[model samples]
Target: MNARTNIQFINNELGQPQFVVMPYTQYLELSKSKQIDTEAGVPSEVVNMVFDNNYSPAQAWRKYLNLSQVDVANRIGISKSAYSQYYKIQKLRKSMRIKIAEALQIKPELLDF
Candidate 1:
């Protein structure tokens, strides 16, 4: 193939790589948004902890709140039957755990994953 043809062929095969790149202004806006979200009463530490895959802050919060499975389920917006499944200790997704921690206003890291 000609050089131009080869370049076109290679480019076609590779396609465009997907990426997420924010300009400085956009980055600042996103940062400000995150700060605002944090300030809206969800503690930063709890948010971080709940998002961290290595921790299960829900367990700790459940203990601290002295809530039974039914109570925790009600507070966290889950069904009591679903919460019962975790009674003997079950894993939670990172987002779910964080949501629970945020709902309880507790540090996510304290859950002891």
Candidate 2:
């Protein structure tokens, strides 16, 4: 309306206040809190086995240490192909199971069915 009215409204708006700047301490804290993982090494074989076998993370860890399918056969004192047959039939012998568990440094119960 009038200059005086406009001035009055402008003063009222100014009185409501607004942020002009963030505090320096808060900015510093935000920068410090940000994180990135730069740690380096080969990924664990246990983790890789879990993904490859479609087994649960725990099972994969156990199997990764037990050795390859071929190695498992050798360690348990069976031919690889025979072991494959036994595996297919769900016919793991008790001695073989114990040998596998010992080789893997795991309890037999940890292995998947």
- CA lDDT scores, all candidates in order: 0.55, 0.51
Kindly list the per-residue Cα lDDT of model 1 for residues 51-107, writing each as its tens digit.
654334565445545667677778778898886665435466666666566666665
Off by over 4 Å in 2: 1-53, 56-63, 86-96
- Per-residue lDDT of 4 in model 2: 31
Range of the 10 consecutive residues with the lowest summed lDDT in candidate 1: 4-13
TM-score each candidate: 0.39, 0.36
Candidate 1, residue 8: Cα displacement in angstroms equals 67
Which candidate gets the maximum TM-score versus the true structure? 1
Query: For candidate 1, what is the lDDT?
Result: 0.55
Clashing residue pairs in all predictions, respectively, total: 0, 0
**lDDT by residue for model 2 (1-109), tens:** 6343211222245586442244556545654775322122212565465556555433454355555767767766778786666453232466656666565556654
- Candidate 1 segments exceeding 4 Å error: 1-60
